[model samples]
Target: MSPTTRVLNASTKALYRLCLLLPLLANHEASAEPLVIELHIPDAPPLTFVNDPRGHGIVGDVAVAAMTRAGYTVKIHVLPWARAQKHVSEEHDHLITPLSRIPTREDRFTWIASIMPMERAFFSLERRVSSFAQAKETYRKIGVGLGSAQEDILRSEGFSDEQIYPLAIGDNPAQMLLMGRIDAWFNGVPESRYIWPKVSKRKLLMSSVGSNADLYLACSKQCSPEMVEHLRDAVEALRADGTVKRVHDLYLPQ
Candidate 1:
């Protein structure tokens, strides 16, 4: 080829390299800005907590597994429900795990496919709250995860405004009840048992309060729809292969 033509081609190739490398450098700069996810991990009966790798919490384990499948790295940050809720609403690209897609939040964000149906209940000092009817009279002076869907249900059920109390994410609310802070703390069936051993030495009053909600993987209002679709596809594959239930059973309160 002629020298002029060769020089022009070489310059074009160099320009292409500069363009590609610029994005790569920009991505490197963006590395410090992580995609933050928020969730409330309460300290209940059998459920537990640990850092990444050990993954002791049931929902945490399931979430890590799903994140692995989705090919996205996630940092598990635990905080009180109020704070988590605030950040999830205000931040960009933030996410909340195990949030029930209630009517109010239906239009809030694009949702990833559900991870599992959260089976919930009430656990007291000694008696089992097997049904909502049974709990109607007995669940006075109750402690529960604040801003939880359970709290929403109870509020709708005419549980006195003063009767429902919010517990810290990692604090033992049942123990608080046993200590007389409240009468009982609502529990998620398997998650409570999963976390029980960590908080209490003995099995307390465990009952299904007849409340259940389909939990979903929810992204913040600003998250891209494409990201949600990819996560949904990843979750579908996990369900197809039965990994989802296996993860749940392994960590479920039994």
Candidate 2:
């Protein structure tokens, strides 16, 4: 009925689920050799946020499953958006998933790619919105989710930081816009829901605001290219067998 009530409900369900997870993971030997992976997922939910030892949600589950299928043990680590990038860059023997692959990131790491599509999501008030170019010029400010790839893309596309605002993971960027804190918010698709209800209360609109991109599983520069190739094959098999789409359709928001 209320925003506080909704958040409270989600929080309680999370705590209840966590209490049941430790004994389950601790007691089991994984079906395949355990490979340590540094899954690079953000706090935005129904995507890669943790449900604990199970490491619940779509991207995380697909990675763990693919790793297991490839005969490697898996370990999931959650990082602040920035630290996750740093960890995958500097850490040895770790893998980061759901990372975007563009010319800029080319040759930076070994990659395991997916046919799956993802987007850099953004939103602004319906009544105030216009062509992206006009919005860029007209709005006094825009909110970018901190630690996101959107930063580089927007910068390369010529967005001035003077027009940019940054918000933490749980901050409601939509609310920020509705409250006149920013003009729009840019982030991943699943993240929009995080601030939707908040904006709805103010009768503001939220809509998709960026181009689509391919997502990948990236390993550190030190990881073997052959290993990366194997991971690529494993993911390809998952796609052929329909596991990738099944998971994609199942957990990810439409």
Candidate 3:
């Protein structure tokens, strides 16, 4: 009836609406700020790089995209291959990318998604070995990434540690081969090809595939179930939507 009463009633209604929206606004703010996750990667090129301004690499790009899609703000750490693996293994809920999914590593990390196929081979400057056995016999010293699946595969195949020259990833294994420090370099086929041109002009003789595996976006055993599920679903969607293939083609164009 009175102007003051009408104004009071309108204010009360407005206050009620504001109160109702407070809880929703809080929830929205909480979701707007994404969960921060640490992502570790090795320096292997065309797969994951340490200092590249454009991006990490093929699989690295995929991992970042998946994590972003899963509502995570990724904090990337570029470490040595072995150190990255150890960091992820020891740190709770931390993630590592392009890790080979092997039997020995199956239980060490919680697998999120398979990023790409990992096909390993031996590359030599002067020789073309057909098989692992031939490589073991023909090469006096074989260069393998330290603490990499390639090293484990070599050891499992009966190649003694004395014959295996373990080098850190991104330490220029191709240079070691070119300098005659190692007779051959054994690593992922894509990585070897990607690095050979960067380090040398000579032709690299590649051997047949030494092993087959899939590189995965994996996390520590203590990773949360929700995180795993979200990342897994994001990766699957990326795969389905051709985002993963597009990222791969950036480095390994066919």
TM-score of each: 0.76, 0.74, 0.88
User: Which stretches of candidate 2 lie above 4 Å from their native place?
Assistant: 1-33, 52-55, 126-131, 193-195, 198-209
Residue-level lDDT for 247 in candidate 2 = 77
lDDT of 1: 0.68
As for model 1, its CA RMSD to the true structure in angstroms is 4.5
Clashing pairs in 1: 45-195, 45-196, 46-193, 46-194, 46-195, 46-196, 47-194, 47-195, 190-253, 194-253
Decide which is better by TM-score, 2 or 3. 3
Residue-level lDDT of model 2, residues 1-254, one tens digit each, is 99999999999999989889866776665533355655566665555666645355566677777788877777677778677877787766578866777666666666676645666655766544434566577666778766666666667667788877777654556667767778777666665654476447555454545667777777886786766777888888988899877877676446
Q: Which consecutive 10 residues in model 2 have the weakest lDDT in total? A: 29-38
Off by over 4 Å in 3: 1-28
Q: Give me the candidate number with maximum TM-score.
A: 3
Global CA lDDT computed for model 2: 0.68
* Cα lDDT listed for each candidate: 0.68, 0.68, 0.90
RMSD of each: 4.5, 18.1, 2.7
